[model samples]
Target chain A: METIVLGIGETLVRDDRHWASWANWLGVPAHTLSALVGAAVAQGRDATDALRVLRPGMDVDEAYLARAAAGRGEHLDESDLYPDVRPALAELRAAGIRVVVAGNGTVRAGERLRALDLPADLVVTSDEWGVRKPDPAFFARVVEVSGAKPGATLYVGDHPADDLFPAAAAGLRTAHLRRGPYGHWWAEHPDVVGTADFRVNALPELVGVVGGSPARPGAEPHSARPAFEDGTGAVGGARPARVSYLRGL
Target chain B: METIVLGIGETLVRDDRHWASWANWLGVPAHTLSALVGAAVAQGRDATDALRVLRPGMDVDEAYLARAAAGRGEHLDESDLYPDVRPALAELRAAGIRVVVAGNGTVRAGERLRALDLPADLVVTSDEWGVRKPDPAFFARVVEVSGAKPGATLYVGDHPADDLFPAAAAGLRTAHLRRGPYGHWWAEHPDVVGTADFRVNALPELVGVVGGSPARPGAEPHSARPAFEDGTGAVGGARPARVSYLRGL
Candidate 1:
């Protein structure tokens, strides 16, 4: 029973829309200096490097800010990582399941992952690997790092383009997270594989995939024993706090 | 040179988001049974017959009240259609271009058009025909009624699954209108031709596809002019619209 679980995407400091929300919160244009500069700095690209290629007049901070203001990047934090859910990585690992997080930028992914401090056996950065997911090459990298065959791996993600279609094309089983910003059409699809797809309303349900029977703060895992007596379990399923730690997206 | 236009869709009598802006002027929700009933009905399903099939037991009036309280499904009268950018459909027709508006229910489509009464040559109802756009058969019905070939006919609509994809598959040249309640994913597609295919931002832009120039309010027909306003015209100097309107799906 060699099992592997992986997640892949651009792990920017914050996405464009969130930057707009934060800008609204700070009463400053969130699309400005903070987003682009942070992305560029995290990705090891300097303000000069970005300027040399695209819009030369704009520097690093300015590019980040403008794009952010325009609502154009992908940003996921822990709370949003999977709201009302728990990352299933730990439970799978405890059951001897290997888990990996593949992303577009190493520095940026490292920054965000470190910020969330999610416990994972491996993290693959596209910047280092030179390819992003959806390209079979990216999936190949995951197979190499996690040492799991594509047939046995499950790629969990939100974007239809970057996640489901691509992973399915690469011979990997997919679990599309329909609970987030998947828009109305994708949400309206009936083939959503309700039970077969491991359809979860939140992240904490990830425990259900790896045969964990634990009780969380509120709901009971579908078929497992209550992992906690009270509200000490992760929002997905109950388990001792020591066996579980929360990670932001 | 004989041009015939057939329109499809539901002429629904439902409230839109803009209706709330005019609630005070329309005498609020306190009086006017027609306005009240009109406000109560939020979609084509709420129309006299369709609503009966969609939500059998749901009372239109009571549903209206509930939604009004929830700050949704507000009523929109004739005056609320705005952004001042809805293309002038009449001028497009007067310039020798045929227009067709197709949908699942013509009641809503008809209402939107009749509200504007922008003057297309023909109005085709889906209910009367028992066929809706996006089905090759529906466009065939449009051709049978209008005597136009599918290739020569141009279908302009908002729903991709319902309008663009089928029309493309049917051989009807498609023009996707980036308006209405349909989601923007279909509209903002980078490769618009791949998915429902052939895209545009507004309705009147279709004129440029045929031999005519972009029709503005009171613009002269293409026959009277030497060429388009500028160098921008259909490819190879062929009337894309005419060729479009003459081909079969």
Candidate 2:
């Protein structure tokens, strides 16, 4: 089966502004907070590192941090998706593609995913795995959990170094979701942009990039290899068994 | 009238690869040629300037250049538009919006427009105007030709300084079409991205950004000030005469 492992967080949710909002709430300069968060993300560090760096000398409050994280979660749950996200995810799922959300997201993001009822087979976050992206082990774990060979898998994300390069290095087809903070950063480097197998602005455009899903009724035929068999042993030959797991990575 | 002036070249067609193809045909490195072309475009120069730079010391063959240009035109004529472009243009025109194509494109591009029979009230090009975008007079000419008040018009383009900044400076609502070479470049700078009233990845998303055409059946109501007065006379009390231009700008 063709598995698509998406680096969720900002790829699916509008989480870039969360850092700025949290900074504003905590009386920190938004730009300073954004830069610190950006630096942490670029280094493949977790959100905790960002918080620690932003509040170095201050008495950090765990409960207040939890509340702030929850606030970000609520913001995400309140329909903060890009316009093409919902329909594209629906179409991909309906077409029988195994969609997974793998990222360096906070625990609250996973909670928000459940609250929003997002469609995906598995969601693996750094909070659960203790390893963030740009780490080869993280992508390997995602491929293993998704039951897809790196060659057959498609890993979509916004970051060039943190997401695209590492995923590409791991042998998965990489797509650059050009929208968020990292996306803007990636755009500046032509060499990085050239590395992505596909660079799309909207999520729905992936339907065209990945080829149309066969299970979608009345969907136009695409040049992409079929995701599954047509039962007559013509197109894909045979339908692969569905891979499912209930535990976090 | 609400006029939408689109930066036609790559915004409406796929013209990037053609440059590389032409460069290869002329025995020049694609990257070197691309950089030279980019430099010219960054200064708001036209296709002719790019050509002059590309073939600086060469024995220029006018016939060969014309044939190559025509080849590019034919490539464009073969439905080289983005997936969302056609439907979006049709819907906008059906809604009685005056659409115009304004850009720093070659004369062959204008011919391709005629061949494709694209829906537009006027088609303007640097080839005809003797000036390119980011030049205040070029935008002024567009405003004068379209009979559109700058505030009421929407200028959609892919470039930051070349397209978005100049149009915005002229007091037009600007939309950054986040595709093509310049789109990727513009996304890198937050300051430039912030200048655009709308930053869209897909052309169909414009139906949402620009209020959906009232003529489209089952269109949702939007909060934008109505482009024209309704019979109820509550919003936009009096309807203005539609500006119709039969000739090219």
- On the 0 to 100 scale, the lDDT of residue B237 in model 1 is 28
Candidate 2 chain B: worst-modelled 10 consecutive residues by lDDT: B240-249
> How close to the true structure is residue A21 of candidate 1, measured as C-alpha lDDT?
45
Error of 2 at A8 (Å): 35
Which lDDT tens digits does candidate 1 get at residues A1-249?
A: 255444543121223344344334433222222222222322223423323222335454465566557875335567444323234566667767676677555455555565676656666567678886557787666667756666667666644445555665666655555332231113223323211233443345555644532222454546323322234543322212211111100
lDDT of 2 by residue, A1-249 (tens): 377888775687665356546665655433334434443443345444545653544444563566557764224555566556778888778877788888986676667665766777787687678788879989888878777677667788877767877787787877777655455434434444345655666677676656533322234334332222333323222222211100100
| Top model number, lDDT | 2
Docking band of candidate 2 = incorrect
Please give the TM-score that candidate 1 achieves against the real structure: 0.40
- TM-score, one value per model: 0.40, 0.40
CA displacement after TM-score superposition, residue B1 of candidate 1 (Å): 4.7
**lDDT (Cα, 0-100) at A175 in candidate 1:** 54
Off by over 4 Å in 2: A1-249, B28-75, B212-249
